[model samples]
Target: MGLKLSGNKGQQSHRLVIFAAIIVLMTLLILYGSNNVNDAVYAPFHVATNYAIKATDLKKWSGKDGYVPFHGNKTMNLQCHNCALVTSSSHVLGTRAGKEIDSTECVIRMNDAPTLGYETDVGNKTSLRVIAHSSVFRVVRRPNEYLQRPDSNPVIIFWGPPNKIGKEAKGTLYRLIQRISMTYSNLSCFSITANKMRKFDSLFHRETGRDRQKSHSWLSTGWFTMVIAIEICDNIKVYGMVPPNHCGKSKPGSKKMPYHYYKPRGPEECVTYLQNEGGRRGNHHRFITEKQVFSRWAKQYNITFTHPNW
Candidate 1:
């Protein structure tokens, strides 16, 4: 009876050990599954950032003769003491602050957002134009129109998904940028790859409690441009960027502002995108969170926000 009892006790102990091992295996599986989900959500931005970094190295290209250096082979040169970040927002319209906006030695603009007609507000001078890879074709269609004044000959920085810059190098956008760069001595273009973008994203999240994974969105061109400005300039000033929901919370009878001042027809899709992302249930680009991050950075860096408070 004693021998039988001891044998049963040993069997029970073996079963308990097996059960614990199974539990640990299940826990590890759950953790790995959660991580995969997070990675999948952030993959696009990651791929894009990485591709951009790879493309930036001109030596990686077999046909190096096709592209010329912008600032004498330097990716970015911050010779200017101060810079201005000019965003396309309706708040700046009718403000007639063109002189102030243009006064800065380095003025940065976004995409195909124009300044010719609204020069009085947005300024005609552009030292740098930050464009997405998706919009490269649009610029190519009307180079003179989009490029604006030839005197400025802004250095273009094209950013996009990794696929767009990597294996798809033969695409029109890539070819166009190369052709234009080769044709125009003053015009030079650069690619901001995924690796650099990831660094900025990490920094933004670390500084602010907001996670891009939780937000389910990538950084906007404006925010990315701001990050570049912070790195290259001693002092930075932003115009026409307001906190999220500023228009909705304004006092009664206040003029409803459009997302872009240049879009006189109606509010652009970006406005809707921002609104959706700002909603409680939404999982899109966290424009508000990015704004908050910028506000925080402003306190730490030599940055200032003008026109529609930060």
Candidate 2:
């Protein structure tokens, strides 16, 4: 089934039928298939987020340059039938979608959103985490929470402007992250090269028909996550990203949720989002504009949205 069996009774029955059909297909394949066999793919295996890397692949990045480990070693192997890209938006609150998000083959989270206290809403399992360079400090601030992943190996990809991530440049965040990777041997970290960053800028230009540099628009972390998802996964389900007009809709006196579920009092989600949309800051992320692009992507590819279901 494209989605999980968390709907009404009739929907459950329909999903049961689909389940039975899939079983039959698998059974027949096992009985009569050739020596070469392939993994069964569900309908949602279209796009995925979060690059899943393991500590075992760290000989120092030798292959692909898109995502080389913190040691600069290897490109992570991505295999997922369905992926869930969980956001930090407060819209995820009270949804109780933890079970559904965990049901996917891979769960990818952004930055350092914790699942410890909010396990009822956000799942505990994480296959990969895509991080923003500016948010690196937050993850390292609490080593006990983020880096000490004994139960699972989650790959982390850090993205930012070239000057900020370059070795010779003044990007102390990347240097700090490199130190953290060495300190925590169990953690596997990856970094997108400057070339890849330019490619993403090209992609943005292609999609929006505007030069990113001229626009003075800094790409959002969500944007990077989406690009990574499209490259690796066959399907993707995005959570907590509000639609483009969600803030503009005339819903009188609606409670404005916080920008991030983890930060309840920091900044209201829609207000900051509106500022991003208006391009108020010199290098601000175009949150609403990014959603518009995401909407187009959902139509063009196997992408879906939840938590206010776009």
User: Model 1: which residue pairs collide?
Assistant: 48-162, 49-193, 49-194, 49-195, 50-194, 50-195, 52-193, 53-193
What's model 2's lDDT at 112? 81
For residues 130-216, could you state the per-residue lDDT of candidate 2 as single tens digits?
988888889888887788878777777888776876544636776787888788777778888787788778777666665677766
Q: Write the per-residue lDDT of candidate 1 for residues 1-310, one digit (tens) a residue.
A: 9999999999999999999999999999999999898676533222233222221211122222222232346444434579888887777887788999888889988887888789898888888888877667777777676653567767777776645653234465556666676776666677665565565566555645456666566667877677667666678888888865464466765666777787777765355545645443445555666666677668666888888656
Q: Model 2, 291: alpha-carbon shift in Å?
A: 0.7
Tell me, by TM-score, which candidate is best. Answer: 2
RMSD of 1: 12.1
lDDT (Cα, 0-100) at 208 in candidate 2: 65
Summing lDDT over every window of 10 consecutive residues in candidate 1, give the lowest-scoring window. Answer: 53-62
Computed on alpha carbons, the lDDT of every model, listed in order, comes to: 0.67, 0.76
Model 1 misplacement above 4 A: 1-74, 166-170, 244-248, 268-274, 279-283
